[model samples]
Target chain A: MTAAQGFRHGLRTAIVSVFALVLVGTYVSVGALAHDFGFSASWVAAQTVLIWAAPAQVIMITAMGAGASPLEVAIAVGLSAVRLMPMVVALLPILRTPRTRGWQLVITAHFTAASMWIEALRLAPDVPREARIGFANGLGVAFMSVAVASAVGGYFLAFSLPTALVAALLFLTPSSFLIGAIRNSRRMVDWLALAFGLALAPVLALGAVRLDLLWTGLVGGTAAYLVQRLRGGR
Target chain B: MSVLGDLWPYVVLVLVGFLPNEIWRWLGVVAAHRAGEQSEFLTWARAVATAVLAGVVAKIIFFAPGALASVPLAVRLAATVVAVIAYLLIRRSIFAGVLCGSIALVLGGLVLAP
Candidate 1:
């Protein structure tokens, strides 16, 4: 497949996927919350473009609302984003081939979020090596468009939307992500990581607010890795 | 200038929100070039990422930040449990899971509204 064809395929898949609808619902919630917190619509839309990750965006906006300093906001957002490093690490290598340019890898990394990453990882194998970059980029562009538009629209709709409906919308991302994690689980380590992370988060939240996720990921992931090693499983 | 002051929030967002987040992706791109995809280090990284995301999911559900916090924690937890069970028993359909979960949340909020 050529780059264009791969791009088209990915674009079509993301546009039609059930996950895209969930993204729309989630970002609408994000936009509404940002509006409630007195952020301009452009601010939320820009966040959708730049941060792209829902969890990090939520953290930054809420922290800002709570009057956290800029430095504090950066630290919290950065901590939430540490997960992206590993996702990009796992994904870029799959998309890269002999002809893949350094610039392409750099550009693609910006578009790597959970939605695009999952789709790309699942779909890259079927794409020709040379076209994988286009495919992933297409997914990134489609999701970004959907997310940003929904956010801006939600900002406008925030006034009329009921609190109950907004609450329901906020539930979309976490439920969808949890289900996605369960679907992606293929091994004991994966299951253990999910279990450990879910159990550790509430406990860690009782202590420090800023570093809970960082600790959860580190401790839970390490525990899973060690358990897998002890079981002699790859 | 007054214009610069007006633009300060966007400026802060770019510096604080965009840069901090994008730096990790850049780091990953640099690292992926050196490490094979299936290497043990990459495996560990994947586990770490997955765990972190799972933590985010739990955070949003259990200790929700915004409007979700308005709904009682028990309702939120029950909705999530219902969603997971529905997803597993219903052909692993993500749509079904999210839909059921969302319906439960809305209904729970209504029933438990004070």
Candidate 2:
């Protein structure tokens, strides 16, 4: 394929992911939660505008309502966002074109996350570096729009919905994450992280003061890293 | 909502979320300059990111709490597996995985989720 064609193909793939997963699935999940929980519509809207991350936003809203300590909530919310660091790192080779210097990247970095990052990552090999950020930003803009609209509207809808249905919709928040996580695993570290995080949640819940799911991430992420290094760095 | 009341908190929240994001972005750029090539740090980042994604997904599908929290573990798990297979069949397209799994969940609820 011509370079232009390759860029278009990569852009198309990224856009598809933005619409299906980021816009449709993640927004639907968050909208469901917004309708059931007292999460501020404006705050969640701002998060999408800025964070564009689904899992961390969801956890932050729920944890706040639970009256969980600020530290606990921050750690859980912050730890889940650890995924962002690696996500950005993985996309480095792809996004470094034009040497996208200083302020421009800082402006755009807010746009990176699982769906966009993952799409850029898988298809970057074929795309020219110059086009990667544009394509990614395009995808990010689409996801951000859906989330802000969904969150604001869903917050208003919650005032009218029956308790039972609101309950089911709320369930979709985590369900979206669960499905996405299962689909994203490509390496041994992924498998271990999934296993360790899942196992850690219930075990932590057993404690007098839950070990906080956030730590599970630090522990699981660290353990996976160590094990991967030991296994000949495969 | 007075500017000083409900809206103010949100203004602060937006500023807070925005700060870290920018810091990371700058850090990404600075770090990128130093590490033009993929290094162990990047590898570690990828591994941790993958694990986090996996964990988050597993928690939602198999272990989420709610009114439907009573849904049996096996059924929830089976639905996720169906989604995974669908994703694989589609050559790892997450769009296919999420939609397929959501459908599988509804169908499962219709059929076996008593």
Which prediction has the highest lDDT against the true structure? Answer: 1
Predicted candidate 2 versus true structure: per-residue lDDT over B37-59, tens digit per residue: 45766666665565555555555
Residue-wise C-alpha lDDT for candidate 1, range A108-200, written one tens digit per residue: 999998878766877788888888999999899998999999999988886688788878877988898889888888888889999999989
User: Candidate 1 — what's its lDDT?
Assistant: 0.87
- Kindly report which residue stretches of model 2 are placed more than 4 angstroms away from their true locations once superposed: A1-12, A35-43, A63-76, A157-234, B15-33, B67-70, B90-93, B112-114
Indicate the TM-score of model 2.
0.75
Q: Write the per-residue lDDT of candidate 2 for residues A1-234, one digit (tens) a residue.
A: 443454456456644552433454446556657556665666677766766777667776677667776667656665556556556665665566655666656545677766666555655655566666666666566656656777676666645655334434444444445545655566776667667777765555455334344566667777877887799655
Inter-residue clash pairs, candidate 2: A177-B57, A178-B57
**Model 1: per-residue Cα lDDT at residue B39:** 80
